[model samples]
Target: MTVMRFDNVSKVFYTADSETVAVDDLSFEVHKGEFVAIIGPSGCGKTTILSLVCGLMSPTEGKITLSGDKKVGYMLQRDQLFEWRTIQSNIRLGLEVQHVDSKVNRDYADDLLKRYGLWEFRNRYPRQLSGGMRQRVALIRTLATDPDLLLLDEPFSALDFQTRLDVCDDVYDIIKKENKTALLVTHDISEAISMADRIIVLTKRPAHVLTVHETHLGDIDTPLKRRESPSFAKQFEVLHRYLNGGNAV
Candidate 1:
């Protein structure tokens, strides 16, 4: 089922003398439980796309709709967890706000922490945990809300290379195991190639949909394994061309 649909959506920012068109007639559909990644050149309006879907901003033209309830959770590159809050409290804050607070959801979050080897640090403040663990906690906080769609905006860019790999694997495991749909925006062609079931290639500023491709790494599903697949280089090469606006097929 198509849970989220964007129909020729366009966004233009108006100023005193000029206007900036961020997204130009972009359209796409996200299937339920699928991981769709959007990759484009820097400042190509990828993050703008997420804002439109989440209702943080409305399109200047066209339409977007969520077939079901439009509950979205956003995870930015920075963990954004409050320094004063413990991991447990951070995870539960969303639930409390949504009024879904209960023993069941609390237990579920606790189980996730324990299962992911974070239980020992549950009472620690965000500053006390390692970068990878903090990002995990940030994701857990996002997930605790049980959002209908998860929007990840380059959620690993700040980590060192080694930590990024470990966090990427951890996040992939969490999202797939939860059976949730994810839409990730990233500039790393390799990262998109590794993590996405489908990849959307976007054009430069005032971005429009140049091309969309269904990508796969055969039956081996781990992000790291996908990166190692022989097809990975080929896919990156193709994506490079698309991103360059050269026959974005």
Candidate 2:
């Protein structure tokens, strides 16, 4: 099933003296329970697409549709946790914002923390957690609201290489465990290839869909495992060439 669709969607920006075309006739579909990654050249308006989907912005032309009344959760490069708030409270923040801080929802939030090995740090502040743990807390916070689709915007860019790898596995595991559909925007080709079931590559701005690659890393249980696949190098090379104006396939 298609959870989201962008049909001939175009987004234009206007200033007093200038007009910019960010996305041009972009069209794509995200299926239910699928993990998708979007990769493109630098400043190719990848983040803008996420903004449009989450209702932070509107498209200039065409339609953006979601399956039914799907709720969205967005995770950015930074964890953006409140240093002063305890970890448990931070996880509860989304529910509080939506004014759905009912007992059931609160219990669900607590359950996530407990199941994810974070119950012990429930009383600790964001400052007390390591970078990776903080990112996990951020993921738990996003999941607390029980979104239908999750949008990740270069979420692991802030971490060191080792920490990023660890966090990627954690985030992927949590998302899959919850049976959530996810769309991730990353400049890292390797990261996209490793985590995504399908990858959407975009052209330079005004951005449009270039090609979609289905990663065939069969039975790879984790992102790290996919990275270690023999096909990983080939996939990386293909995506690298595509991003650099070379034809794929």
Candidate 3:
């Protein structure tokens, strides 16, 4: 049930004078319906990995595989919604881009808006919605395409602390309810601990898998609830130590 696999994947950027290695021998697997988070220090090529998966960039050496013909939907740091487009039109952007803007896809998009409580705002512009709601719309737009795997590239980093929390819960609920597989790249240790089923830690530069931890907090339904769990602090400390190059067990 592995939706995606990275086998010794390496990515290098070559300029006129020098070549910078962004990823080195990276290997990871994301299974069906699982939320996996990649955490590492800043400038660790985390975004490069997502680009590789989405076919925006090819690996310099090694292979990247997706099960069957799984399509990947990327939710970026910003909502990236067109200011001129109404919510309804914005939701259909992906479908239109993919040339699949048929009745069925449009209906599915409307259904998502309704289910997520954004139906009332369908005629409104992105400026009319709050930051959190805008993020929701962006997610729904991504879902409109019905991608097999989702790539979340720091999707909530732009939000304030409280809004980030609320949006995290909403996004997690939607993803779980839709039974979608997600791979999130985040620098927030607590965010990773709260939302991910497994956390993949990477090295500083020329990123590679440093370690992996299975978050045993799946039973705690929401991100806020998971944050309140007694083990939250302990897990955060473990990840923190790893990022700081401390020996942690």
C-alpha lDDT of all candidate models, in order: 0.89, 0.95, 0.96
**TM-score per model over all chains:** 0.96, 0.99, 0.99
lDDT tens string, model 1, 1-249? 998999999999999999999999888999999999999989989999999989999999999999777889999889889899889999898888889899999998898788878889988899888899889999988988788899999999999998988889889989998888999999999889889999999889889888887777637668988888888888888999988767744
Off by over 4 Å in 2: none
Compute the lDDT of residue 248 as modeled in candidate 1. Answer: 40
| Clashing pairs for predicted structure model 3, backbone only | none
Indicate which candidate wins on lDDT. Answer: 3
Better lDDT candidate (1, 2)? 2
Where is the poorest 10-residue window by lDDT in model 3? Answer: 63-72
**lDDT, candidate 3, 1-249, per-residue tens:** 989999999999999999999999999999999999999999999999999999999999999999966688999999999999999999999999999999999999999999999999999999999999999999999999999999999999999999999999999999999999999999899999999999999999999998999989989999999999999999999899999998678
Error of 1 at 9 (Å): 0.3
Better of 1 and 3 by lDDT: 3
Clashes of 2: 0
Which regions of candidate 3 are displaced past 4 Å?
none
Q: State the TM-score for model 1.
A: 0.96
* Model 3 TM-score (2 dp): 0.99
